[model samples]
Target: ILHSQISTIEKQATTATGCPLLVRCKNFQLLQLVIPQERDCHDVYISLLRLARPVKYEELYCFSFNPKLDREEREQGWMLIDLSEEYKRMGLPNNYWQLSDVNRDYRVCDSYPTQLYVPKSATAHIIVGSSKFRSRRRFPALSYYYKDNHASVCRSSQPLSGFSARCLEDEQMLQAIRKASPGSDFIYVVDTRPKVGVTTLVCVFAAPSHGMRDEAMLPDPLREPHLQGGFAQPCMAALLSCLLGPRSSWRA
Candidate 1:
């Protein structure tokens, strides 16, 4: 690590989480630092940056030198993701969509997580029936709901029916999903499944009232998604693009 010993300049003043820093060398070396003091932490971090990249004299090095940070009102790291807090940010449990623990015990869908957020228009019967029709009972569920346009990102496994088969209840549930997002004129499908799977979703997800768009082929995912307020992981860029559209800036 770059600053492993942590030059204990101040014994009294110490960071709550013990100021940790990571530096990646060009030779594939990852160095870590845990400066205890606030001033020392800042000093060590800046020193590391300067060491990595030298600057000219009187150039105001710190002016346009911005560093990425993850923080809140309090100091913490590797925090557990709170589902309620996350959904609250999305402005859920409104007239259109609601949170249901119907699958709390994972009885309806073993693969799906508890606390299902779905369209309020969908009935209990419709959900149960939809589960039965889907592969591994992984029925359609909302992944993200855009507050700006009220556009949603719903995910689901392939329907059990390959192409010819159809499920009335499954169709009804998907129809309710469209009604929940009134802002969008079209229901864009981002299918990562094979040809038969993609074709199956199109066959079942298509409704009479809503237009269907097959965006199965996702755009090249950005290498650094966090630059534009996107998903932290680069792989998720494809899903984010498909859900939010090509010209989207959905904050993580």
Candidate 2:
């Protein structure tokens, strides 16, 4: 009986026998109720209507409420994956890539995690300077390192580039990335999106005239649809093809 599920409430009629109330839910669940008493049906409808639409701002969502925390409770789930342990598995702190503490104070990139792994050639000064070139101060940071080839998959926000926007440090950073992966001449940029509307999902209300009027109710219209197939899907076929190629140990 979640009020959020309620979409459209239709009052059929209030005859002598009873009142037929039709409730269409967000999930397209058609709820047809025939209340025996006319007054009770009106009361129920009014109650449901009030509950569905909260008048107060805070009543909209339960995010304001804070549950009591157990002082004695100690959860060890957070300690499962220590930074050092993960780096150890990757065989890092080598010649190609090294651990970076430039963002330890979170001054360089507030959006990024405090801990970061950058190219070995790029110094702390270069890392700090390069942040200005990229969006949200998200400078290129190592996400994965292929042990065999010293190849790395660096993640970064879009570069703040325009006609005149340029940074020498950012250029040096790219060079450092290239240097890390020896024998590799060029870097390939892969766009995950297939096309404009092939894999694109629009909001239910965004394009009312686009699709059929009585279309299937989408549960999560806001959430970006998971890429089952894309032109250049990141972290998988696109990046791995450049690194592993058609024939590799990772082949299924």
Global lDDT of each candidate: 0.63, 0.67
Candidate 2, position 117, lDDT: 81
User: What are the models' TM-scores?
Assistant: 0.49, 0.55
Give candidate 1's error at residue 144 in angstroms.
0.7
lDDT tens digits, residue span 180-247, model 2: 88747655433233335422323432432332111232112111232335433564665677566654
RMSD of each candidate relative to the true structure: 17.4, 13.0
Scored by lDDT, model 2 comes in at 0.67
Error of 1 at 104 (Å): 2.6
Question: In candidate 1, which residue ranges exceed 4 Å CA deviation?
Answer: 1-79, 161-164, 195-252
State the number of backbone clashes in model 1.
0
